[model samples]
Target: MTETRKTVWGVLSTANIAVNQVIPALQKSERLVVGAIASRDEDRATAVARRLGIARAYGDYDALLDDPEIDIVYNPLPNHLHVPWTLRALEAGKHVLCEKPLALSAAEATTLIETSKRTGKNVREAFMIRDHPQWLRARELVQGGALGEVRAIHVSFCYDNRDPANVRNQLDIGGGALFDIGCYAVAVGRFIFACEPERVVAEVDRDPDFGTDRLTSAIMVFPGGRRLVFTCATQLVRSQDVQIIGTTGRVSIAVPFNQSPDREARLLMDDGTVLKGGDPAVETFGPVDQYLLQAEAFSELCVSGSVDPYGLQDAVRNMSVIDALWSSEETRGWADVRQD
Candidate 1:
């Protein structure tokens, strides 16, 4: 019998997502291990490493990238630092699983694509929802025509966060409802629609104090006249819901994003048979950690030297849609989405 070697991952920062969600999930994977962690503040990094059982802690990010023992680097840093650091990690000869919205703009994201090609290292934007079973099943239903002639998707995601010191509230570093949560809407729409939108129009409300977008609503028109309507907010009651509407039926995701790993996830399918308050057919998925699934998938790519189906190009496309939305907000009219 041969012993399989696990891929070692070094984390770039003790970001909350990395420490509280991603690192814990990576630790649960059989094929991946958290080798080290780094933060500008050495004490904070050391404390996190101690708490998380990570073997090494570096005071600076470049030091961790310099370590040869690390097979991959998981970057959960803030939005502005995403591209620069991910590029550095690739230049240092390590694959990177970067946090979502890979860059502040489509132009910025192209650098990661270029660097990844130059370095022969795989880099993936960490949109964990793409790996969850429920989302997969949802995509399956869409492809299989479960909801006949699917024409539209409606999404509502919101949460209230007003802390002046919080990173999400900061303006200069890509902090806004659109970049924070609205990008999920764009990604999932592309995933389910299986194509990019033709044009988008948006309305935004910026916070008076923080200067970040607190609320955003956008409509995307896809090929075949299909549409996606979504709203995301950083200063509203917490909620999330997604509905796929079709000519003959509807599919509603009960917990679309931020699904609990310990509870069963569900979907409701309506065929229009019960018009008077009857129950829709329910599809349930057992508890599973999406973050763990995402880590393991990225690890496989790390070992195989293969490209992710939703790799840099897909991220660029997603960012392009977001860019169009921002453009629409500025122009107060429909803006064409850049496909390339």
Candidate 2:
């Protein structure tokens, strides 16, 4: 019997997402092992390591990267820091899973792609929602004719955050609704439609005090003339959902963006069922920890050297849409997404 070697992972920050979602997931994955965690303060790193049962703790990010034993690193740093850390990890001959909005714009994402190629290591932007079975099921339903010729996608993700100091509400560290939640909106639309948007239009409102964008709404026209509209906000009632409206029927997901582990998720499609005597076709998925599944999937890629679905190229596409949206905001009109 061949002994399976686990992919050893180090974490680059004590960010809440890393601690709450990712670390727990890594701890639970069969193919991955938690090697260490890093913080600027040695005591803080040591405390987090002890609390999370990580084997080692380093006082600085480079210490873990400098370690020859770690195979990969999970970087849940500030949005602006994501690309730099991932580049460093790749240069060290380690794979990277960096939290999304992989980079500030398409240009940086392209740089990441080049860095990955030069370093001979891979970096996958961590968009955990893409790994969720719910999304997979949605893609299946959309492409399988459950919804005939999807014409429009609507995604809404928002949360009310009045805190001035939170990174999402700050201007310097790349804080805003578009970067915070719109990434998911754009990603899910692209994944379901399997196409790129040709043009984009966007509206954004800035916070008076912080100069951070409080709300962002955008529309993208995709190949085959399909369309996606998504709105995200930093100060709004919490809501998350996605709908794929088609020519024949429409599929709707109840909890689309933020996959809460406490509740069951459902996908429903009505195909002239209400007018007729038939009930709507429905499927419900039991609770799943998407981050855990993401860890397992990424670990599998690291171990097998298989290509990641959301590698730097995919990240670049997503960022390009974001860039187009920002451009539209400036022009208050349509902006073209660069065709390849």
Candidate 2 global Cα RMSD: 2.0
TM-scores of all models? 0.98, 0.95
> Candidate 1: where are CA atoms >4 Å away?
1-3
Q: Please, what are the lDDT tens digits per residue for candidate 1 over residues 1-340?
A: 0126888999999999999988998898888889999999999999999999999999999999999988889999999999999999999999999998899999999978777888888888899999998999999999998889999999999999999998899999999899999999999899999999999999999999999999999999999999999999999999999999988889999879999888999989998875787789999999999999998898887787666898899989999999999899889999999977
Least accurate 10 contiguous residues by lDDT in model 2: 1-10
Q: Over the stretch 150-233, how does candidate 2's per-residue lDDT look in tens digits?
A: 899999899999898799987888999999898888888789988888999999999999888899998999988899999999
What's the lDDT for candidate 2? 0.87
Where model 2 places Cα greater than 4 Å from the true spot, the runs are 1-3, 272-279
lDDT (Cα, 0-100) at 245 in candidate 2: 91
